[model samples]
Target: MNIFDLLLEADILVQISIFILLGFSILSWSVIFHRVFTLNIAHKKLKLFENEFWSGIDLASLYQKSLSRRNKLNGAEQIFYVGFKEFSKLYQMKRCSSETIISRTLDTMHTAINIELKTLEDYIPLIGTIGSISPYLGLFGTVLGIMHVFVELGKTTNNTATQIIHLQIIAPGIAESLIATAIGLFVAIPSVMAFNYLTTQINNLDQDYNNFIDEFITILYRQIFLNIDSVLNKENKHEETENKTCY
Candidate 1:
């Protein structure tokens, strides 16, 4: 008999199990497609932003360009914007030491990274939960189907003139029960694989954000020292000019 015929004849509980598996399969695939698209976009945006950042552009100019698209900034760009804004604020105030400014800017960037990570992780746990539970749900349906087949067989043997068993009588029922497990595995395998692949993508993006943060902070530190030296040099040149006038 065809799968549809078997499903029609299957026990009610088994039918429910199959329907649930089908639902999980649909939801899992939906999440897989969404994440694939999202992560791919994130990766491309990050690469583009990184290339622009490292192409000898000034930080203030980069910040201004990013500001134009502030609402739509990607992961790496968002980090740069947040970190640079914080550094600019603290540097302008000049009330805090350089160490304090750097520390505060680092904290702000870390918070931005966490927020970006959370956004990337949306709906991922649901996929993991479905993969973990689908097999057990299918197993439950299979066990119930087998019990139903056995109960029916006992009734038939009681009515028969001779105590005999037939392969045809049991084969269809067993086949129906096994279909639940087959569906479960079908749903689970792809969900698990997609989960792993998406998770790796997230981790890679996270690493890129961290590396950028470190490099950006180093640049900020150097700029601070350069400004200090420039001020000291200007003051020394002014004093030398005054000494020449006095002579």
Candidate 2:
């Protein structure tokens, strides 16, 4: 029989269970598709930004470019911009030592990473919820359907015709009830797979961000030493010129 026929014949509780499962299935699929697209974009954007960042370009130029695309800035770019801006401000102020500037910059990047993680993980729980609850929803429908069939069977008398008719009814009802379980599995398997895959991707990105932070700190340290060296060299050169003139 058609799905409409089975749905029409289902007990009220079974119908309710089926409808609820259907709703869950729709919402879970939506979350899956949305997350796929968003994460893909995030990965691509990060790769593009990383290539630019490591190309030996100046931080000021990178920061200006990032600012121009502020609305479209991805996770890595956003973190870099926030950390760089803070670093520049603190360095120029000359109020904090090099260590303090690095510490504060790391803190800013950590905060931005947390925010990016939250955005990346949005709606993930919904997929997990669907995976966990869909099977139970289907089982509930099956249990309700079985109970309904037993109740109808009990109503029939000892007449052979009545018993045979009830048996026929039971067969169709049982088949219809099992459809709920099938649908539940259909909803659950993909959700579980998607959840696992997305989780792995996010974790990788998290590690990438952390590594970048450490590498950036090292770059800042080198810049500080280079500046010190340049100043010292200028002083030595000036002193030598004066001594040579006196001699």
Candidate 3:
């Protein structure tokens, strides 16, 4: 007969274990599909944002674009917005030193990065947990099923003919219980594979974010240097005009 028939004929405990594993299987698959789509979108957005960010657009304009889509920002775009917004505020104040401004900007970006990464990694642990424990749970059911079969066999003190008939029933019953182990492996294998693959994608996204942060910081430094030089040139022009007037 089919596995469904075997399941129907299984002991009560084995049935319960199978049901639990089935639930785990369902939930794990749901998470797997949801996470796959979500991560795929995240990676695509990351690539698009990287291209736009490095196209030599000014920070203020890029920041404005990000602000307009505040609801959709993710990965490097979110971090850039956070860092640039803080940098703009502090730079406008003119009181904070460059070191303090950069430090605060970096801190803000780091915090945003952590938040985005955490959101990306949500529910991944559930997949991992299911993968790790489903097999052991199935084995527990298998062990119980075998123990039950042997106990039944032990009680048969009748003639070999009756005992043989008893074993005919016991054999299928034990095989039915081992189905739990099979189901466990079924649930575990895909979940483990999905967990590892999704984690790797998340890690790659994080690395992209880090690289953008470093590049943005360098860009900010160059902007700050140019601003300082411009201000110094203005002061020099003013001094020269004053000297000419005095003479």
Candidate 4:
């Protein structure tokens, strides 16, 4: 018999299991497609932003450009916005030491990175859950179908003239039971593969974020030192002029 015929003749429990597996398949595919699209866009934007960041542009100019798209910023750009904004605030206040400003800016950027990662990971766990449980659900249906076949066979032996167990009688029922397992694996395999793939992408992005944060912090420290040196040089020059006038 064809697959449709077997499905039509399947036990009610087996049909329910098939339907549930189909639902999981649909849901998993939806998440997989969505995550693929989103991650692609995110990676593209990350690369574009990184190129702009290292192109010898001034921080204030970059910060202004980023502010224009503040609501839509993600990844490295979002971290830069929060960190720079905090740095600017503390620097302007002049109440905090350079160390305090750098510390607070680092904290702000870390928080932004965490929030971005969480957004990237949305709905991932649901995919993993479906992958893990779909096979078991399918197996449950198969077990019920096999039990049903055996019970019907027992009833048939009591009514039939021949005390014979036929392969033809048993094969179709077993085939129907096994279809559930087939459907279950169908749903599970892609879900597991997609889950692993997306997880790797997220991990790679996480490493990129950490590296960017470290580099940006180092830049901030250099800028702070440059400003301090410039101020000290101006003071020393003024003192030298005063000493010459006294002589």
Candidate 5:
């Protein structure tokens, strides 16, 4: 029979499977759209933050501006704040060696990065799982329906008399099987796409964080440490000049 005829002739269980597949498709698509929106906003905010960070702008001023906003910022800014706070604290400590200070600064930044990574990745894995499994579940239902159809087909020995029941059984079973593929496609396409897209974004952000961390740390080492050493050397030179003049 024709496709419409098959659909029209499908049994209740097969129809139910189609409905379930459609539901999963809708749910997966919803997740895809939501995540896309979230990630896009995150990237926008992150770019804004990075530009502010590298602009020779004062961290204190930036921190103050960021803190004033109630819904103003994201994890990238938080990571920067944590790093800047550590840098300032170390600067105040005065007694620490440069090695100790830089090491502590990097350690703090790394921890903050890990926390932000987790926050960014929330609920994404579950979306991938739903995408991967929903189709298989649909296929399982279809298989069971087809098996029942065949079992019904085997029940009678008469040829023409059994054929009508066979059509009723087989039509829905075939439709159900085809829908399993459709459901599989429904679940798999967006899921694979979303999973891959999000993963790539995470990697890019991670690289951006690492690069910025290195650049900012290098800036601190040059500006803070060299200035301190220069002042100390000048003081020693002047003291020696005074001693020579007095002698």
Candidate 6:
């Protein structure tokens, strides 16, 4: 039988399942493309922010600059924004002495990493669901087709008393079973690939964010505790020696 004609004979409920699977495949593909573009942008933006962060501007400056509407927020921006806000709030509250500020800042950065990862990880479950279940749903369709084929076979045996040959009995059932499995794989393969690829990219971005935060905190430690008086003393002595030598 023609594949089209077999499709025409398929039960409505089974056809609906196939349609649902197809829709899921398309949605999963769309998500894959979107995440690919977003993750690429995130990587580039992270590189940009990491460069600026290494130059040793004060945290307050980074915070304020990020808070302003001018700096475009990307994945790195979000992670920094979250950490900086918490640190600033704690500093204002006098929650830590100077000695503990760095330790507390590390905690805040950890929390920021969680928040950013969760935000990126949203919708992952749905893709996973589609991948895991689509094939079984297709199998269910095939089962229904087989059950239907058996019923028709039994009816033919009573009417003309002609034995239903195995091939005739099995033909549509075999076709439907394979078609159902094919549809399932069609939905599942791409969904699984998309899920794994997006997950890897998200992990890489998260790691980059964490590394930047760790190094950023180290930079913060030095700048905040600058001994201004020591620098002035050296400059003052240099000036005194220069004046005496001139006289």
| Candidate lDDT values, in order | 0.84, 0.83, 0.86, 0.86, 0.72, 0.70
- Ten residues in a row with the worst lDDT in model 1? 238-247
TM-score of each: 0.88, 0.86, 0.89, 0.88, 0.80, 0.77
**For model 6, where is the 10-residue window of minimal lDDT?**
238-247
lDDT for 7 (candidate 3): 93
Better of 4 and 6 by lDDT: 4
> How many collisions between residues are there in candidate 5?
0
Winner on lDDT (2 vs 6) = 2
- Give me the runs in candidate 4 sitting further than 4 Å from their true place: 158-167, 229-247
Which lDDT tens digits does candidate 2 get at residues 1-247?
9988888888888889888988888998899999999988888888888898899999789899888988876689999999988888776743344556677889999999999999999999889988999998899899888888888888899999989988996888887787788778888899999999899989988998898889877887787745765554565566553222211
For each of the candidates, give the backbone clash count.
Answer: 0, 0, 0, 0, 0, 0
Error in Å for residue 9 of model 1: 2.2
RMSD of 1: 7.4
The whole-model C-alpha lDDT of candidate 4 against the native structure comes to: 0.86
Candidate 3 lDDT score at position 49 = 86
Local distance difference test, candidate 1: 0.84
Of the two candidates 3 and 6, the one with more favorable TM-score, higher being better, is 3
Pairs that clash in candidate 2: none
TM-score of 3: 0.89
Arranged by lDDT with the best first, the candidates are 3, 4, 1, 2, 5, 6
Could you give candidate 3's per-residue lDDT for residues 4-40 as a string of tens digits? 9999988889899999999999999999999999999
